[model samples]
Target: MFPYFCLLIVTSFCAITEPFYKKQKSIKCILLSCFIVLVLFSGLRYDVGMDYLSYKTWFLSGRGFSEQGFILLTRIFRSLGPTIGFNFFVFIIAAVTLYGAYRFIYKYSSAPLLSLFIFFCFGQYFISTLNLIRQELVIYVFLGCLLPLIIERHFIKYTLCIATCSYFFHYTALILIGIYFLDRHFSAIIKLSGIALITISSPIIIYLIENSDYAVYLKLDIFVAKVTVLQYYLLALSVIIALLYFKCFQGKPMTKKDILFENINYINILFGIMIIMFSNTPIIQVISRLSYYTMPIYIILIPNFISRLSLRSNRLIFRYAFILLYTLIFLVAITTNGKLQHYVPYHSIIF
Candidate 1:
């Protein structure tokens, strides 16, 4: 727990203060190296999360097609030290995802550091690291890899292929298929209006799901349980983002990319709200996992918005405020429900 807290604090601090040096390759290299070291160290800890144990057992037993790809990949590392090797592999996947996300933002927006900070601050990545949900992690990495192509050319075929591979890793990735179409077509006003409607009607959606016959097929309690806290954050964050968008609107006209990104954010907010509200329902609950797919876009969009700010003081304040908010959230998440564990420090140097 201490190690985890330290990592979050250091990461968040660096994210806030490091933006000025983002163009420096040395800074990127140093930060990247430290991140890798943390990943290696994290492997030394006991398998704290049930998700890790289940995946490890499945890999060891030569399980079915489910997780076969991940199993096959990890099997090679199993020869070294199962837990450490598996952690290394997961770390590489996450690193690649982060790099891909960085490249995506750099390609699309002028402010890459802001984009990276947004991604880091999002609680999902921090919690997922501790939980080690390999499938979801892999899907996120793949989505990051697919971002450049999706944003530049808007090619449906390639997008579908990437989305398919993501779904293969985790069925929840399928929800992103809807997002792809939404990005391509939806206008900002329409998207935001739709999200507002969803937010307003969330309780009704939850009530219907709780009472509906479809509840028999879907076990929504787990989904509901997971989403309650997440929803609160999502709602707050969405409102903040919407306010930013409106505040920034008069200064610069929205670009095509900006519109696309805003629409994506709106869809994510809507999806997140639905998941939170209807977590007790069957199909709607399953839809909640789609939040991960939309998570990166916020990072991509928010930073770009921040970067456009003209005042240095505003940027600094915004950066610190965002980092502090996320850092607090990250702490609360790990410490909640006795989820934190005091396992061996997962450093690279072997003891």
Candidate 2:
């Protein structure tokens, strides 16, 4: 909680001050503080995330490395002993993921620090460092590589990035590639219609996972869960936000670059909603897994949409509205300690 608030203060303060802080030195300090708080909070924490023990167990056992890349990574981490190695591994993951996200938010967002705040409100960074370690690292790294290529419409480069990411996290990376490609190419009518198709097909996905011999190999059991009502509310909120951003862009005059970036984010939010809707079926966790690629869009889209509004009064109302909205989301996340995602009270091996 201490580190969490520290990060919030830094980002929020910088959000207000960045426009006036023109000096390169001042800008560096602000950015440094942001990364410093993020790294320390996420890097030093011990026994915090739900998967902490499990990840430690894997490190100690020296297993679960699917390829030479991970095998070498684990070896390097464990060279100093399990605890030290695990913390180092965590710090590396935290640094890489947070930095990548910083680039993503800074590149596409209207308010970079505020977009980061939204990322914090959603608990994206903490959960990535603490719980969903391998998957999140792979996804963000892959995502960073994918964004530019996607905008350039360089399919070959995007495919290579996906393949590279697969080396780190395997089939999960492939799943994201498939989902994102479809989202990018699909028309609005087809996008919504495919949602219906996916909803109807879940039972089949479930049936195959439940009874198929391949389920064990594919690890489909991990995704088994019933979608809750709270998730439905979140899903609805996402749809509203996506729609709002889409409509916001409709009336604006923008360059091809701006339009391309906004439209990509538009796809991200919409696809994220589609994936969340699919959670209502048997393979609930799969949607959660898939949402990672698309969820970052909201961090920027929300801020971008509000800033691009036609009325000053409307912007003010939404500014406060989001302040309240993010505040509640942040508080609820803190109270839960990421229990749902397996994160919580800050702990550190060094302490």
Candidate 3:
């Protein structure tokens, strides 16, 4: 709890100070400081995250690795064995995840520090890294490779990127290939209809998968539970913010990057709605994983939308609103989720 709060405070301070710095060097220093804090705090943790024990055990025994990349990483670190090696493994994962996220935010975000704040606070992305190290790593890979290809409208490159990432990483990431089509300049009506169709069809797909041999792939029964009420509220809140952005851009011209980002956000909201719609189903985990693929868009979308506001007062209002709303969500999540409950009384190898 102390460590998490410390990170929030540090990130907030950096975010507030960033716009005033102006100098590239000063900005880099500030960003670097925040990144270091993120890496060190995440890397140093012991028994302080959702899957810390499980991952450590896997590292020691050399099993439970699903992805080939992760298997290779485990084997490389097996040389150290036991505690020391596992700590190093966690450190490497933290470094890779934060590096990818920070690099993406720096490249795409209007306010990188604010985006970092969201990365830490919104949807527990930073916290979840302790549990989903491989997923987060694979997500960043998709963002780095698939994003540019989608924005530039390179079909062949996009397909190849998905195939390559899927082979090396999680097969679930292959679900992201759907984004390439969704990224196109489809009319809003068509896109909205598609969102509705997907949401509507989720249960049917879940049933079919459950009945088939592929049920093992989804692992739907292991973590059977409903998404929390607070989670649904957050998803609803995301949709509202997205709608505000949608209304703002109506009838306005958009650059290619902006158009794709805009659609990406809409797709993100669609996943949010899907989670809410399927809150009761066994397929909640699948929806949650799919949601993660688009979740990074929030770091970019929310900040970009706020910056686009026509009035300074509106900007300030929304900025504060954003922080407050997410802070409340963060509080509720930590209290409610069993895995997040483990985040309390943070421990580190150094201490």
Q: Which candidate number would show the highest lDDT if scored against the true structure?
A: 3
Q: Which tens-of-lDDT digit does each residue in 44-141 have in candidate 1?
A: 43465545566567656656445455556667767768666766755665565455454555566445544454555455653455454554455455
Question: lDDT of all predictions, in order shown?
Answer: 0.59, 0.64, 0.75
- Angstrom error of the Cα, residue 164, model 1: value is 5.4
Ranking by TM-score: 3, 2, 1
Give the per-residue lDDT digits (tens) of candidate 2, residues 152-182: 6677777777777676545567765553343
All models, RMSD in angstroms: 4.2, 4.2, 3.4
Where does the lowest 10-residue lDDT sum fall in candidate 3?
332-341
**Model 3 lDDT per residue over 17-50, tens place:** 6556668777667777788888998899889866
**For model 1, what is the alpha-carbon lDDT of residue 126?**
39
The TM-scores of all predictions, comma-separated, are 0.76, 0.79, 0.86
Stretches of candidate 2 off by over 4 Å are: 9-32, 179-186, 199-224, 249-281, 337-342
**Is 1 or 3 the stronger prediction by TM-score?**
3
Supply the global lDDT for candidate 1. 0.59
In candidate 3, residue 254 scores what lDDT?
A: 66
